[model samples]
Target: MSLRTALVAHVVSSSFYLARARILLSPAGDNWLRGRQRHFEQGGVPMRRAFAASVALLSLALFTLVIVASSAQARSERTQATTITLSGWSAGKDEDDLLQSVVNTFNSTHSTIHVDYSVINGDYSTAMTARFAAHNPPDVFYVDSSVAPSWIKQGVLQPLNTYIKKSKYDTTKFYPGLLSAFKVGKTIYGFPKDWSPLATEINSAMFAKAGISTPPRTWAQLTADAKKLASSGAVPGGKPICLPPDWARMLAFVFQNKGSLASVQSPAVTAAVNYYVGLLKQGLAATPTQLGVGWPGEALGKEKAAIIFEGNWLLPYMKSTFPTVHYGVAPMVKGKVNGNLGFTVSYSLAKDSKNKQAAWTLLSWLTGKKGMTLWMSKGLALPSRSDVKAIGGRKPFLAAGPFAHGWGFPNFSTTITVMNNDLQAVINGSMTTAQMLADVSKSLKG
Candidate 1:
């Protein structure tokens, strides 16, 4: 164990050190500490002097204690909190701010564990993979459900089963489906922090203007509604729906048709892909890029699309960036049955971490009720734990929770890159749906 003493800055910067400082700064303790210092100086023994300076240094930095503190009034041993590094990709400035604030609270309240939060820029999975290969990864990092399979296979994650059992952590609180997504066999790898199930978001004003009263309930009705909205020109220079060529989004339709990534060449998958791309082909749907926006959420907010399919993460963005945009969320339109894609992420521990127990302290708190409630209650994303209770118009997303399927591929990054290209190719008419399915099926085999 490395004990690097802390230099506390705030009056109550770190409770462990601050408690001692409070005593040392008092009139009676001040005189006592001073007397001990002179005795150590005259004797040429710097223990007392170092002790005094340690109290002073405690006022400056939040680190480990360097010396043993002794006084006639009390005798106690103190040390700095274990520094645990945590990294994840940022969703936006607002989300980053909220997470930072939460981490600050964790640091102050936790005397033995301090979490250092950093956003890994660019591709999250790619950067994390490199760090793991270098044997210098953060103590804890986000494990997106889409990449969990590959990460689990690589053995870079510290299994959470022992920690959970030892702590008697209640695993049943989280939604079973979400929790299962982070598991391999019976070994628990991580705890889901939050989840979002795909749903349809409709522009209220546009739907009314198109003479449609409600969001579409099925694929057929969605197409019919889009045609009416297009003919009415309600969106003006934009299409009736915004559909991104993402496997995560498309997988919802596949599941609805009783298909899965298990067999990309299945008849169910074929029908699902064709139906999804046909909208783009018929000019009733447009990608966010076509509408000059960054994401489907932005396209909806900018009124570039009458409808869009997204998860609950869009709620906070809409609230902050486009509060005035009148919209309604509904379950994703069905094919043969109800299905939706669930996106979840967990705070997983690194196998190479020097501070596994300390990292668990931070990780557990992050996914625990207190930390999760403070973060997820803001409508930032749907809470994975059922008791946390979603806020503000979240029923539609919750409705799809039962039939929602988690997304991940064999070789996550490479598979997604191939899937994304083939999906876009079919959408843009460069490739046929049949060719796309065959290629995707081939990639799955490889």
Candidate 2:
């Protein structure tokens, strides 16, 4: 019998209490109970004895009813298998093979709870928000670090701190500074999965043709080097480096300038903006249209531009599309400060999920050792956990993945527009450095 069934038996055996009481209350029962009763003593039972016997019988029946109900309650709470749904942005054809492998592994081992996964199109932000508004959100979904703050403000994400503490793996096991992107107040909203650093993808052939032997290590060095390469007439395009002073690239310069996006009062932002504009004026970088480059990856493949600052994702595309192009990866040079932007995404649970425990099971499997290793094997972004770096080291392609000082890009949610537009203006020569930063600072107040 099951433990539940055994417990029911114990409850039924407890009826012995009522049986013993009934026997003691009866005159015959009392005589039988006496240790030393005179032989052949026979007497009729008293009215009180008869009344006590009737009462004892009634009590015993009531007691049995209670035990039956208790046993029934226990059976209702038994463990049962559950089904959970997961949502993410791994819908692209390129990501299909890796994502499907992860889902299959989880489904095989977690027979009690199967994960029903769906990959939404485009960005997860747009798709997830719409689903939540419709009141039919998935149990779990992808949460990019860049957009986590918006979700937190909407009160949509759940905190995983308590769960993390109970986990065998500690938070410190992953890279520091990156986790805060998913935090609001004292609660952590998401689990960081993978990250890539900002780096320059150089065409070695282009560099050699330009009579350049070294990649620049600082902003000044980059400008000077690009100038030298330009004068050599060896660069395929008219310009040597294809730097776009767009909002994304501008944020990196702002970070490297020791400027906080949300600082109380600091002028470092202006300095960074000025530097970016200066580079544009000096012709170190070009706008997309000017270079006739539709995509950075395609541009690099066609050798339209010699050098471009991009993240780790570009590596695979370059290898597959431009297999013959001799290329090498170099770290992001120091601006006024040492910093780089991290292209990162995380897995987060819904605040109102019906199956919280089952949902966590899927999350635990995906972000844990097994899930991380499977994803890393595809040679995509680097894993957040330190131990997983060994897998990256096994392949030459992954070793050259984007990272500087072994750190990925930093998240700066504050002054996003200012960082975006201000730097673009400066680079495009539409605004001065001071004007761009001041405009950005004012924009932050809105």
Candidate 3:
């Protein structure tokens, strides 16, 4: 600083101290500093002492300024760390713990981006709906195939094409069917972290007792096997097959019959539904609920069912919950083609997120090959990325990823409820299959 400016600053500092201590400097807001000699001569203290003190105080003030500037920069840097909020629903405690560990790993390895994660264990859709309603949803969250369409329609999810292109992220690494689940037209909204396709879980002992050495490869064979198991009377508490009255399961059948959602009222769709309900009607297959089980997995664990169609998630559940339940995994029975519903979730970005870049960093890392491999190693779900190999007996689930039908429909929550209710009604003899087809066709159209 200039000499005059330094002297003026010194006077201001000295004057503050003097006011506090009830003392006085040449007081005129440093006006007397311009006439330093006259002020020193008239103000009655030794001029040398005053000049020396002012110079010392001026140097101190400059030092303090440097410290303040450096401290401010440090504060700025600390505040620059981007915080991303992530949310999802866990399949079980093990899956929850696994995901939390992955999140912890990400946070530790990343310096610029930090993630705050939460698991919405109960009704994840409702919780996330509330967040989006308030325009304060988490930066990234699990967007399941069933909800992707509706969320995209609501404009809560941002398109990731720009971020992907800028980051040069390898989208091609993901299974095309799984990745396309979150894509609306050509614009990709998110990347699948991992995926699972419906696969048959057959109780080998039950099949063996029924004298069936091979798992069914086609719907006809499945029917024959179910019949043999039902008539054999060797099956335990469960029936030949334990199926759920879920629209998701219905979609699997619909796809297997070569019936797309585009042809909801087609003959193929009707035939698929008939065949599924036929097994139930003939007492060969029973809904898990009818067998006094919470879900198909529960039925499988309790040995209540000889077979169940579930995702690779069943493998982990079987290992932890029912270790003695010997089973083999096979692709879902084929109809006109090999059809399985791909149950997948993507790490989707929120449209209202202020930290888009940081959120993308976390989302991409979780979906990237390395991060996915770390997660897939736990063997809870099959890797969505083609480059990431399946661990344990995950190959059956992984093999279906490329050709699996990534099924989803508009107004999915409502549509699923309707479809499931209708299917169950038909199963319980409250409605005819024709009636269900007509009602669902109307709903699907409307």
Candidate 4:
């Protein structure tokens, strides 16, 4: 019989024995026993009856103990199973599937902790904010490097330093740049799950049609090739390159010039802006919107543009959507330095989580070497942990990690908004490069 069935039988038997003993000890039962003893004259009837009652009582006590032990075991098992909620924003179907696979692996391996994952379909920060406000935030959630500074300042996240210290988790195994994005002072708030570095995606067919034998390796070469590609009418819209005017893409140019958004008026910043503007003026490059596409990747995939700058995330999208298009990925065209923008998201624990310890176990397993290796093996994003080697197409992204810079800062959100607006004005010929820089500098200060 099953253990539960056996326990139920023991409980029932014990109750029956105890009930019989109670009846036998009653006044009526004692009088009957005396009558039997007088009639028998042997007087051994009372002694035999008393001995039988004692044995029944002992059996009842033993069954009762067994039942109690079984109940305790069931309670302990229930107590050991902890369910934790993990929330994150969905990147795409491939990334989502890969993450779910990893989570499934974690759940299967861990007996005590269970992670219930939910993907926020809309704005992740806004959704997480509402959860925090309701005092029912998830045990753990994703924190993008772009908004980490703001989230950290808001105190919605729990610092992982104590847990890291107690568990002796090797924090040094992660890429230093990616790790720094989630840190404030000496306390780390999250662990990077994965990262993507910006790189150039070129269409070999388009290059060959334009009579170009090689891809550009430097900004000057890129401009020269763009000119030839545009003049040759290799692409349908006659645009040689499509570059998004957003700060994420522009930041690479700024950093390569040894400039920073923090110092918008620096000579390096001005040069970077002017160079991009010049390309637009010469009709060698067009923004993705101007090319009538949603993003640079789409522009390239649709053959609306010959060259574009994008990250590793584009690879899967292109392969699935535009499989026939032949393309090659190269490191970002060189400037003063071999600079590329890195985008990363980390798994952060909620400060108010009641199951903080359980949540940390899930977080550690997800970002641990084995988990990261499994996740990265799909080639969706490069592994953040140094101990986990990059496989397949992820190697280039990993190689660029050491030199890449993450896009996280206290004022990064504000800077991105202001810079994008001001740069768009410059590209439209409504504002001069100097004017754009001065305006951005003034806005940043305010």
User: What number of backbone clashes does candidate 2 have, counting pairs of residues 3 or more apart or in separate chains?
Assistant: 4
lDDT of all the models against the reference? 0.84, 0.68, 0.83, 0.83
Q: In candidate 4, which residue pairs clash?
A: none
Q: Write the per-residue lDDT of candidate 3 for residues 1-110, one digit (tens) a residue.
A: 66677646644554353353332234563555556656666776788578767657655665555565577677886688788899889777778888889999998898
Task: Give the winner by TM-score.
Answer: 4
TM-score of 1: 0.77
- C-alpha lDDT (0 to 100) for residue 109 of candidate 3: 92
lDDT of 2 at 331: 74
> Which of the predicted structures, 1 or 3, would earn the higher TM-score when compared with the native?
3
TM-score for candidate 2, residues paired by index: 0.75
lDDT of 1 at 106: 94
- Candidate with top lDDT is 1
TM-score of model 4 relative to the true fold?
0.82
Q: Against the true structure, candidate 3 has what lDDT? A: 0.83
TM-score of each: 0.77, 0.75, 0.80, 0.82
In model 3, which regions exceed 4 Å deviation?
1-76
What is the per-residue lDDT of model 4 for residues 91-183, given as tens digits with 9 covering 90 to 100?
A: 777888888888899988987888888898897778888988888999989999988988888899999999999999989888887888899
The C-alpha stretches of model 2 lying farther than 4 A from their native spots are 1-79, 390-419
Worst 10-residue lDDT window for candidate 1 reads 69-78
Judged by lDDT against the true structure, how good is candidate 1?
A: 0.84
